[model samples]
Target: MYRYLEQRLAVRIMEFLRQRYPETALPAVVIEQPPKVALGDFAIPLFPFAKPLRSAPLKIAESIRSEIGSIEGIAEFRVAPPGYLNVRIDRAWLALAQALARDHVPKEEATSGKILVEHTSINPNKAAHIGHLRNAVLGDTFVRLLRYAGREVDVQNYIDNTGVQVADVVVGFTHLVKKSRPEIDVLAREPRFDYYCWDLYARVSQWYAQDKQNLQARSETLHAIEAGNNETAAVAETIASAVLRRHLETMERLDIEYDFLPRESEILHLHFWDAAFTKLKSAGVLTYENDGKNKGCWVMRRAGTGKSEGQQAEQALVQESGGERVLEEEDQKVIVRSNGTVGYVGKDIAYHMWKFGLLGQDFGYRKFYRYPNQHECWISAIEGEKHHPHFGGVAEVYNVIDARQSEAQSTVIEALRELGHNEAADHYTHFSYEMVALTPRCAAELGYALSEEDKTRPYVEVSGRKGFGVKADDLIDQLIVSAKSEVDSRHPELGDEERRSIARQIAVGALRYFMLKYTKQSVIAFDFKDALSFEGETGPYAQYAVVRANGIFNKAALDADEFARNVANKIPAEEFSQFLNGEATDEIWELWLSSSKTSYVVNQCIATTEPAYLAKHAFQLAQLFNAFYHRHPILSEPNEKRKQFLLATVAVVRRELTRTLAVMGITVPPVM
Candidate 1:
């Protein structure tokens, strides 16, 4: 409703300006909310009109205020000194209209193309760590926000099943432990197989360091996995499939799910790279070098390059700079190596082209896993079901990879543009974020020894190869334990199952909010203490506000819907308007204004591609509700109309906060 009003007001302001200043060119009128409710419900600066109107902003504002007179739902307009039109809303009218709204409020639909969001592309080798959670949580929250805004979305999780990471784990089981394929399969069936691989992966890393010749086994394992049709390949597939299942389970605990899991193995077996290779060669995007360091390899001209120092020096000798100075082999990135094996980047380019449905190919689909909700998640296969949900051909793609892959991401975009798919390149988003590290205190709490230098620093980086990071499941379990202690201390009379359920809700809320509270570019130094706190700007704090509001309705023996239905016909117009417009009621009015701006905040979040704004808005809404709860005692108030109005305020806040939390992927417990 607030979103609708903002647009309506803008139209009136623009119409009035065009009529009043016929000869002058006008800019788009910008509507802004004032910092305080006392100032205004909305503010528009007159400075944009100053020079065009040939008048001071103050004079222009006053003139416009006089001309745009008596708009409905507007109480009054005041001209501030330096050129601002502050418009106060008709508080009584807005309050009554919103209160009497039906059970369901329709959202303004968003007009956008099908959006493909690829995130949580964890390697299928070991347990997911704290860093992977940041990526998954951020991507999942954004997906929720997009769906809430009425966009068609497809969620994908890319699995690097045939990558070097998986090969290393295979090396450990095959060469180091000297285990046969059947033995490795037995080990994989044991509980926490991913955890076992985590330790084994570290041992393999150390074994390679001990002697370079030990690395030969890794090369053999990788080649077998890539080539297929061998025991080494069979072992790799068994281990990768098991580890991928563990990764999915870890993410499901946080309520994250995906529509597709695209595997590199299928990408190789289904000839996706071959199709992409033909396109690249036909378009002259890949060059075959015959006599240089890259002899016999096919490479692409790397994006974001400048002349080398030696080339720049030679170019100065000629009047016209020599064209590219006989391009160095080092200047190109190898798409296919001298050994005829495709590189990782080459496979990624093919994957992205498939994402945009430009490769003229598609994967054979197979149902891979099922969520607790019984929704089937599909995986790519060479031979599979005859009928399934179509996976690709998206109009917009967001790859939620980390910032370190900026160069590789750019290369893929450049590949798209070089293929004459300019629109696809333009629509592609690299959605990059920085890494997550643990605070020094957190590292110590997890029993990781820290050097003095580490203690002095703000955060300690984790190394998966060294087996020195917190597993995603481990972190979640620890959070549940911490939250459970709090829940049990506070509600000992509750049954064990109920208490555990509430604790799990609080734990997930804390973890997801902690991941989202920071901007994407900001490096997160996660700390358990900060995340689980109920008194600060954490998930629990926002959720507590909703719980408090629910308690009020329960104690009064009346729900918000019942009170809203009864209020309109019982209270006199004068009495309701006085309660809303009186000077003493300004703080209460602020809560109403904040609750109504949910749509406004959603628009801002989508425009900026930032979820942090939504997080901050939710925290502010919660804060406002807490203040209102303390300042105005609804149940204890004697006046019937005043009590009803206060309860209505609680109802609005509760609804908005619940919606906000849902978008953030945070669940509120019934008795938190």
Candidate 2:
């Protein structure tokens, strides 16, 4: 919100400089937080102009500091070591922050355009694992944060309902178990159907190992499913749809909800891919290579321009001629196989084109799942619901998947470029994070006792086929049980039902925060012991700091409103020592510094597509608040007014911390 004030000051400075120097253009100015509370609240690094300012940077800084006094909301200004301008805000100005925050009842606005975040697109045949949690949590956080920043977001969980995984599951049931829909539905009504399928899917993989001919059954099943007209296809759909519901229920437990469910089967059935293929061909991007690779299929001349073939080719050319330079060639990605069918890259390119409204077509939608006739989920196809609201027309799109898909993602970008939809391509973003692996303790707890060879690697890999990782529900169950016991211990007055609710909050918070705390690229080798901590860079600790802060506010008989009135309260520059006290107030000052840096974290996250920045800030905010909590005797302070101001500050910080965690997809426990 203060960005407006910063903008105004910058304009005035630029105008003032322009009047004085007619020949020189006004330079870029940065408005930033000062290093210390004693310093000016905002600072500008003039060293960027050490050459322009002419005199040494410090003298120039002092001159600028003197000139800067013309601005209001500024008290005294000083130059820090190595020539940084330290501008202290008038304490009275900070008091206005409370009012500004009050007047600003931030409405969570819809995103500027539709944001269809495709995440948790897990294979239908396997059980949901901890690796899936990372994708869903990060993707969901993006939806939350973007909405908070006033963006309309639509959360979508892509289901590979007709992929190889589901086909394998179909083979397992129809061929292996010889079970029909009613039998499978009965099995689904039982507990852990996903877990059962998880084992069955792995066993089915092994079943193929017994005989090479058995693979034909899988291939035929896949063809029949894709063709969408046979009993086998019907069975595959039933299994795939059921598994998807199971996955959604798992996500719902963690407070994740979605607007739509996009099935790959629908994408194929709707002829959206055919429409996309038509455009690509008309645009001369996709070629019908009837002769190339000795094929009957269509293909894309790899986007690479042949120079990327490698230096050996270039060296060979040089040896033949010795006088010219050859550039690296780029490789072509295949669109259609030589067998006259689409490849993974081809379907993905088509899906991406459709995502950005670049493809001249639309999917029909029907009422998705209706929960007790109140909650409705949407399904898309060629002739589904004809009057549903627009789904595509996204100003921005984020696909949250693993880093392994970077090359595949690039192909989508290339498709957009080839179609001349450069703006849409620019808006397309890949939110890639390293995979979540198992720490030794977590692995051992999950019944994956590692060999010495496994220990040699930095982290244990999570393999779906191996079925050797923590299931999301299993992890949540453990955390809830652990947390419920703590709740009962701390609050002996509470009933079992109330304690269960509290435990759910704590458990979900801990899991979501742990997943989000690192930058997306940082591989989380999650340790059970570390994940279970209630203090120090943990979710419960964040809640603990807030509760402690709230306790101080309550003791002073203050609430969010009353405390907000003092955000701009004046600091007595003369009584700096009394305020600092080399105690908790000092800790408060450090927390203040970190809390103020939240805007920077947010800006970086927006630019880099990294959710970990928010996670790291949440941890830092909690750590600082905890230190402040231990050092200050809040209600017992001698100066009532200063204590009131301190309590007010705590209220604001606590509100902010709780809000930050929510954006990270971690709900704060009500009584932590």
TM-score of each model, paired residue for residue: 0.93, 0.89
lDDT agreement with native, every candidate: 0.87, 0.73
TM-score of 2: 0.89
> What is candidate 1's lDDT per residue for 16-85, written digit by digit as tens?
9888778889989999988777788889998988888888989988987888888877889998878899
The C-alpha local distance difference test score for the whole of candidate 1 amounts to: 0.87
- What clash pairs does model 1 have? none
Name the lDDT value of residue 317 in candidate 2: 81
* Candidate 2: worst-modelled 10 consecutive residues by lDDT: 323-332
lDDT of 2 by residue, 1-672 (tens): 344345566776566556555776446877787765555567777776566646566876676666744676455667876867776544434334533353222344332566778888898776799999999998888888777665677877777788788888888898898897789878776557888889888888889989989999899999999999788888887787777778878888888877777778877887778888888889988766444343566656454342446756775787588533222112445687777678777778877887887777777887766555366668776578657866765777899999988878877787788789998888888889999998776777777779988877778988877677888898889899999999999988988898899999889888888888887888999788877776677778777777777767666666755555544444443343355334345455555445545555665676688878888878778777776667767788789767755665576677668778888777765575
In candidate 2, position 312 carries an lDDT of 61
RMSD of each: 2.9, 4.1
Q: Which candidate is the best by lDDT?
A: 1
State how far residue 491 of model 2 sits from its true place (Å). Answer: 1.5
